[model samples]
Target: MSPDLRVIVYPPDAQGGRRVRVDGEILGRALGPNDLFEFLRQAAQDADDVCLDDGLLIEWRGGGPALGSPDAA
Candidate 1:
């Protein structure tokens, strides 16, 4: 994952799937980190080299990883 790439994981939807966007382009919906990784991989990103915890790489909106609901407090 390039440091310049802006990755955003949106809030979880009713089915607990989150929308993933890379560089302003919506890749797809991810249900977990593995799904997100696959999406990144398909986007030509170094998924294995990318750290999901790195805020510089991923900007988790509404909730962070481990959050499974949009209503999560």
Candidate 2:
């Protein structure tokens, strides 16, 4: 993961599902632990943060410098 590029994994919902959203847009959905990890991994590649249900907040710490800017540098 890049320094400035953080990855967040929110807690699962009541039904045990997670969502990958950015700026109020739905990107994907993960329905299990494995799927959630995979989602987080993929999101990490782009250094993006994800929220499970637009509430919980979980993020990866101690990353290197961002490969690019958030606006696509």
Best by TM-score: 1
Compose the digit string of candidate 1's lDDT tens values, residues 1-73. 6777889999889899999998889999988888888889987898779887778889999878779734332
Which ranges of candidate 1 are over 4 A from the true structure?
A: 69-73
lDDT by candidate, in order shown: 0.84, 0.40
Query: Alpha carbon lDDT of residue 18, candidate 2?
Result: 50
Give Cα distance to truth, residue 68, candidate 1, Å: 1.3
Worst 10 residues of 1 by lDDT: 64-73
Give candidate 2 regions above 4 Å deviation.
Answer: 21-26, 40-73
Candidate 1, number of clashes: 0
Clashing pairs in 2: 3-64, 3-65
lDDT of 2 by residue, 1-73 (tens): 3344333434455654455453344556555434544655655542144342322343412221121112211
